[model samples]
Target: MFEPVIAPSGTLLGLLQRGRGDGTLHALAAPRAAALTALNQCVLHDPRHDWQVENRSLYYARLFLDLGGGLEDIEAHLFGPGDDPDADETRTGLALSVLGHLASYGRDDALALLRGYAATGANWAWALDELALRDDDAGLRSLAGAVLGRFPATREGDAALAAAVRDAFEPRPWRLWAEDRRVSVGGRVRAARESGSFDRWQRQMRPTGPRPDWSVQSVFDWAQRGADGGSALHVPAARCLGAVAGPDDRPLIVETARSGPDGARCAALHYLAEAGDPAVLDLVETAVADSSRTVADAAVAAFERMCGEAAVDRARGWVHRPDALGASAAGVLACRGGGQDEELVLGALRETVRADGPDAPLLWALADGAGRLGIGCAAPVLRHIYRETSSSQLRGRTARALAATDPSFATGFAVECLWDCEETTREVAALHAETRDARVAERLRRLAADPAEEAEVQTAVRSRIVPQSPPF
Candidate 1:
C-alpha cells in the first residue's frame, strides 16, 4: 500500500516500499533523497529483486558521470530505466558498489557509459578501474583497455582495480579451439608470448589445427596499428614481428610495410629487403601518394631501404622537382645516395641554394641529406647553406650535417662557416673543432679572439677553441 501522508515532494525516492524477485518493489517517483528515505523505511518490509537491482545498478552508475555528482547522489536517488518498483540500492550499496555488476553482468549500457566518461580526456579513475576489472570478452575489453592503456598517466588511479584487470587480461599464448566459445587460462600466457619465451610457446601453444580466421584477425589488425601495435588475440599475432616477416614470408613483410608508423614501416622494409622480393615494390613505390606525411615518409624510406641504391634513383625520378614535394623526394634519396646520381642531387641542391631558396620550409628534407649523402659531392651546397642561409636554424643544422659524414676539412669550408658573423654560422664552425684538424683549431682561435663578435658567436667559438691548446 502507498503511504500518502509520509510521501514528500521533488526527486523520486519517496513512495517506495519493499521490492522482491517479482520485480515490482520500486514504486517511488520523487527525488533521490526522498526515495532513499522511503526505500529505507520499506527495507524492513522486504528485500530487493536481483533483476531490478541489475537495472538500478546501471542507472546509479550513470549518475556518477554528473559534472559534479558523487556517491551521495547514488545512495539516495539511484533508480534504473525500468517500470519495476523493485529498483533498490540497499544490497548493491553505493556508487563504487555497482562496478562489479557493470563489468560482470555483461551490460552494454554500463560499458557505454564508462566509455563516455573516458571521452572527457581528463583522468577518470572510476571509469578506467571498472574496465581494468573486466575478466572476459576480448573484443569489448580491448576497445576500452587499449585506449586507457595508452595514457599511462592514469594508471595510478584505482591501482588495485587496474592491476587486477591488467593481470587478468595480459597477452597469452593463444590456442583457441573454436569448437566452442571459451577463454583459456594461465597467468603466464602473455609473458610467454612477449618475452619470446620459445620454450613456453612450444610447451603451451602448438596449434591443434589451422587456426580459425577470427584468431588471425587481431594479428592483421595490429599490423594496421603500424609501429605502436601489439596483441595476444591469435597465434600469428602472438609471434614476434621479426619471425613473422622473415625471408620466406614476402607477402607478410610487404603487408606490414603498408601499415602505419615509421618504425614498423622501417622494420617491414628491412625484412622485405632481406626477403629479396619485388612483390611489395608497387606498395612502397606508391607510398608517396599516401595522404599522411608520416606514411609517405615511411613508404619512401622503405623503398630506399628495401630496394637499396637503385630504389633511391627511382624515387628521385618520381620526385616532382618544381616545389617542396620535389625537394623532399630528392632529399630522401640524397641521404641514402649513390654517387652516380651526383648530377641530379646537385641540380636539386642548386635549386635549394638560391637566395630565395625554400630551406626554411624543410631543412630535414634538404641540407641534412645533402650533408650526409653528398658530403664530398654536396659540400659546396652545404657550405652555401652554411654561409648564405638567412635562417639561423638552417645554418646550425648544416653544421651538424657536415660533421655527421666526417667532413673533408681540407676544403677550408669549416673556417669560412665559423668566421661568418652570424652566431648560427659560427656555431656550425665550432663543431668542426672536433675535426681535431689543426686548421679547424686555427679557425676557432681566430673566432674566439674576435671581441666584436656577437655574444653567441663568441661563446660558441670560445667553447670550441681547444681550451689550452689554442694558439690564439
Candidate 2:
C-alpha cells in the first residue's frame, strides 16, 4: 500500500488520522457537521500507515457514537458502484472493524449493516469475524446459507470452500454450520474442516531448508542461493553453521566475513557477532565501509548485536564518526550504555533529529535512551518528536519518555493522551495523568465504566481511583 498523505497535526482530520486524543476533544467541541464530515472521511479512506498494527477502529466508533452518526456513508462505500468485493483486506478492514465495535456497543443498525455485508459483501470474512464476536447464534446461523452458497458443488468450488474455512479469523459461524441438520450445509462444512486440518498438518510436516550434516561450504552456498532468489536466509544459514561447523571451520567463516559473496559475508557477520568473536569487530568495520548497501546494513546490524564491555568501549570511539556506523553506535550506547553516557546519548538524539527529521528510524532508540537515562534536557526534543511524527508507535515511545523526564507531563500531554488512539498510550496517561484536572477525572470514570476500554487501561484507572491506602 502507498503511504497515506497525513494532514497537519493541528487540523481535526489530521488529529483523527493520527489517532491523537486531542482529535476527540476537538471533534466534540467543533460543529457537529464538520466533525462528522472529518470522521466520515477517515472511515472511507483508511489513514493508518500500518493498518494491521496501528488501531483506529474503536477510536472512530466512539466518535460516531458521540456524534449520533448515520451509516449512510459507510453503506454507500461498502456497496458503491466503484467498490471491489475482492479487494485486499486493507481496503475494508478498518470500516468493518469500526462496525464491529459499534455492534459491540449495542448499535442495532451497525449490527444489521454487518449482517448485510457478511451475507453479500466482497470482504465477507472480515464482516463475519465482526459478527461472530457481537451477533447472536440465531443471527449468525441465519447467514450460513448465504455464505456457503458463494461456493458451488464442483471440485474447484469445494477446494475454495476448504481454504476459506481454514483461513477464517473466526470459526464460530463455520462450527455452527458444521452442526446444521441440513446435510448439504453440514456435510460441506464438515468436509472443509477436515480438508483444512489436513492442509495444516501437511504444512507442518514439510521440510524446506537445510538439514544436519551439510558442510560449512555447502551452508554458504545455500545462503548465497537464497539471496540470489531474493530471500535473505543468511541469518538462519548462520544458525545452521553453528550446528555444522567446529573449531577447524573458524578460519573459513572468518575468511567469508572478511571478503566473500554478499550472502556468505552477511551470514558470517551475523554468526561471528552473535558468537562474540574478538576478531569480528574489525571485519564488521570493513563491511560497513563496503559499497554495497546490503552489506553495509548487515554490518551495522551485526555491530548493534554486540553486547560486551569491548563493544561499549569500541562504541565510544565510533560514536562521533558522523556516518551510518556512528549513528548505529549511538543507538547501541542508548540501549546499553550507562548513566554517565547520558551526554553522548543526548547528543546522538539531537544530531539524529536535526539531520534526518522526526520520522527517521534512528530516533526510536535515541528517544528511549533519553528517557531511560533521565536526561531532563531531552524532554523538549522528545516532545517535538511526539507532536510532529506520524508514527503512533514512535509517538507512544515519546509519551513514555515525556512521562519520565517532563515536569509538566501530568497536566499537559498526559491529559490529551487519555484519548490517544493507541491503547498503551492511554494506559500511560491513566497511570500518570493528574486527576486534578476536571477532564482527567471525567475521562478516567468514563474509561472505568466503558466496556470497550482495554483491560490494562481500566486496571490503571482503578488503581488511580482507589489507591493502595486511602488518605492517612
Candidate 3:
C-alpha cells in the first residue's frame, strides 16, 4: 500500500482525513459541494496510516448522511475502469464499510449498492460480511448463486471454497446457503464447513519449536540456528534459559552475554536482565554500543523489561545518553518513574516531537507520561501531536492526556471529540464535554439511542443525561 499524504492540520480535507470530529462539524457548515468532494476523496483513497486498525467508515458515513450525499461516487470508484476489486482489500474495504453503515441506517441505495458489489466485486467477501449484518434472510439467500458460482466444481475450486468458509468474518450467509433447498450449494457448503473444521483441528495438533526440557546451552544453539535461518527465536529462547539455568549456570550465562555469538549474546542479555543479575546493567551498556545493531536492540529491549529499583536508578543516569538506550530510558521513566522524573519525561516528549515530528513512535509513551504525571505545561505539545499525528490510536492517547492536563478540554476538544472515529475518544467526550453546547446534548441522545455505539460510551452518556421516562 502507498503511504497516504495528509493535508495540513488546518485544512478541511486534512481534518477529515484525520477522522477528527471537527471535520464533521466543519463539513456540515462548509459549502456542500466542496465538503462532498473532500469526503469522497477520503473514502475512495483510504487515508488511514494503518487501515486494519484505524476507523473511518462510520465517521464518513455519518457525514454523508448529514450532507445528503449520493452513492454515485462510491459506485463509480468501485466499478470504474482500471479498478480491480480483488487486487487488495485496502483499496475498497473503507468504501464497503461505509456502505454497510449506511445500510444499517436504512438507506436503500447503500444496501442495493452493497448487494451489487458483493455479486461481482473482487472484494466480495467484505461486502458479503456487511450484508450478513444488515440484510434479511431473502436478501442473503438471493446472493447464494452469484457468490457460490465463483467457486467451480473442480478440486482446486473446492479447496478455495473450503478456505473461504474457514476464514469468513461472518458465517451467517454461508449457513443460510447451506440450508437452501433450491441449489446444490447445501451439500457443497456442508462439505466445505466440515473440511474447514478438520483443517483447523489438524493445525492445532501439529507441533513445532523446541521442547520445554532443553538445556540452556541447547537453547542458545537453537536460537543461533534459528537466527541463521532468518527467524529470530532469542526471545523465547531467553524464556527457556529461565527454566534451565541454575546458579551453576550463572557464570556461563554472564560470559555468553559478554562475548558469545550474536544470537547467544542477545538471549543471554535478555535472560540476565530478567533475572536482575548484578552484572547485567554493565553488560547492557556495552551491548548498546556493540557493532551489531541486532544485539544492541536486544540489549535495549532487555533493559526496558527490567522493573527493579536498580533498573529505574540506571534509567535516570542513562536518560541523557544520545542513542537508542537513551530513548528506551525515557520510555522506562514515562511508564515507571516517579514525580521526580516529570521534567525529564516532558523534555523527552518535546525532543522526540522536535526531532522526529509529531508522528514519531516515541511520542506514544511520552504522551501517556505527560498525562500520568499531570504535566500541565505539556498541553500545547500534546495538542500539537493530537492534531498533526496521522495515527488515530496515538491521537486518542493524546486526547486522554489533554483531558488530564488541559483546562480548556471540556469545552474545546471534548465537544468535537464526541464525533471522533474512536469510541474511546467519544467516551472521554461523554464524560467531560460541556453539555451546555446544543451539539453535545444532541449527540449524547443519539449515542444513547444508537444500538451500535460501544457499551462504555453509552455508559458514559448515561452518566450525563437523565433517564427517559416510560410511556404513560
lDDT of each: 0.45, 0.90, 0.92
* Maximum-lDDT candidate: 3
205 in model 3: Cα distance from truth in Å?
1.4
109, model 2: CA deviation in Å? Answer: 1.0
Ranking by lDDT: 3, 2, 1
Q: How does each model score on TM-score?
A: 0.35, 0.96, 0.96
Tens-place lDDT per residue, model 3, 324-352, is 99999999999899999999999999999
For residues 10-35, could you state the per-residue lDDT of candidate 1 as single tens digits?
Answer: 21232121111111113222355544
Assess the local accuracy of residue 90 in candidate 2 as a C-alpha lDDT between 0 and 100.
71
**Per-residue accuracy of model 2 over 1-472 as CA lDDT, tens digit each:** 5578889988999889888988999999999999999999899889887887788999999999999999999989887775576577677788889999999999999999999988888889999999999999999999999999999999999999999999998999999999998878999999999999999899889967554348999888888988888888788888988888899999999999999999989999998998999998999899988998888998898899899988887888899988889998999899889998999999999988899998799888998888898999999999889888888888888999999999999999999999988999999999999998999998999999999999999999998995447687
> What's the true lDDT of residue 277 in model 2?
94
Model 2 error, position 186 (Å): 1.0
Error of 1 at 220 (Å): 2.4
- Name the runs in model 1 displaced over 4 angstroms: 1-217, 223-240, 246-249, 252-276, 290-297, 304-307, 319-329, 353-358, 361-384, 387-393, 397-472
